[model samples]
Target: MDVRDEAVTIPASEVLLPADLLVPAEPVGAVLFAHGSGSSRHSPRNVAVAHQLNRAGFGTVLVDLLTPAEDEVDAVTAELRFDIGLLADRLAGIVDWLATERPFGTTPVGLFGASTGAAAALVAAARRPDLVQAVVSRGGRPDLAGSALAQVRAATLLLVGGLDEQVITLNEQALDQLTSRAELRVIPGATHLFEEPGTLDQVAEAAADWFHDHLHPQPASA
Candidate 1:
């Protein structure tokens, strides 16, 4: 089915975050994206994955965790981008908005995060276990979620690049801390950004499969 994509402004805390919402016709579930440091909803890599999710009959919300002003400051100072607590709080607020808002409120929700944003996503999942059903991390820094890692109830998938050894170790350590069902998948020949040809496609496919399995159940035979 064709998906309808729209630009939206979501109020979180005292700031309005810009986002792109894409809802497929008869979507099975919806996924919210928390982009990596220095990136916005316009991130090409995340946008590619969102498009893939949309084609898979899943809705997606690509949101900017930082406001324009904060983004400018973060660009110069590089401060807020690494503030996992603040980022997680904003992500939790967005999840709250999704649970109470129209059209999306009733849909099952998942989270897809990249880099440091992955830590924020995990922390948000820990904070709102009842609202978030599943989570996917791409080339992420899940360890930065700290003690919140053990509290996340959502079924989580950590996708790391095989070539990124240091990050792979960190993800493994974080995986050990997760009490919920979680798995680590490494994409061969891919680095931190998965810039290799066809590597990002692998990440998207894995994430789509994970969300499809966990977010909602398939209908029983008629």
Candidate 2:
């Protein structure tokens, strides 16, 4: 299993976002990661999940949704991170890039989002139904996606922490609005961050299974 890991810059919404792209030899599919509020491409949690997916034969792209300057401002205002529309636009732009510019263009693409990034992923999936095949959210705020929730055609899995009652309620409410194949699984004894022992590992395993089940490689172009 030879793997290629590289740092890349993705053009999205008129900004260049830094990203880490990891692809194993003959990948089964590709997954793009959308980090949560105030997080970056280096998010340890997302990195852990991406590693799991990579071992499961999925290529992954972990992207920073905000530019460095914007991140600086966001750290102070805490407003840009919550701007769902802005984040979704960037995520959608990344999806478009993966479909057109990447060598794995023919491969199916999935999205893994965390926190508010989940809403952004859902919105991106709705916007690019033809390219995005599946989505998985970890402690995500799907309710933040608004009406875009109904437009998503991708199979979606929402992973919530069983101990995070408020987020669980929010996810349940959002589940009803989903029109595609959607399911919510609560990881018992885990909180919002899934920081409890072995909880994050469960999140990674579940996400790997979800993406594996839903995404498959397509015939490459001649």
Question: For candidate 2, what is the TM-score?
Answer: 0.96
Per-residue C-alpha lDDT of model 1 across residues 79-175, encoded as one tens digit per residue: 9999999999999989889877845547688999999999999999999998899999999999999999999999999999999999999999999
Residues 35-98, model 2: lDDT tens digits: 9989999999999888888888889999889999999999999999999999999999999899
Q: Where in model 1 is the C-alpha error above 4 Å?
A: 217-222
Every model: Cα RMSD to truth = 2.8, 1.5
What's the TM for model 1?
Answer: 0.96
TM-scores, each model vs. reference: 0.96, 0.96
Global lDDT scores for all candidate models: 0.92, 0.92
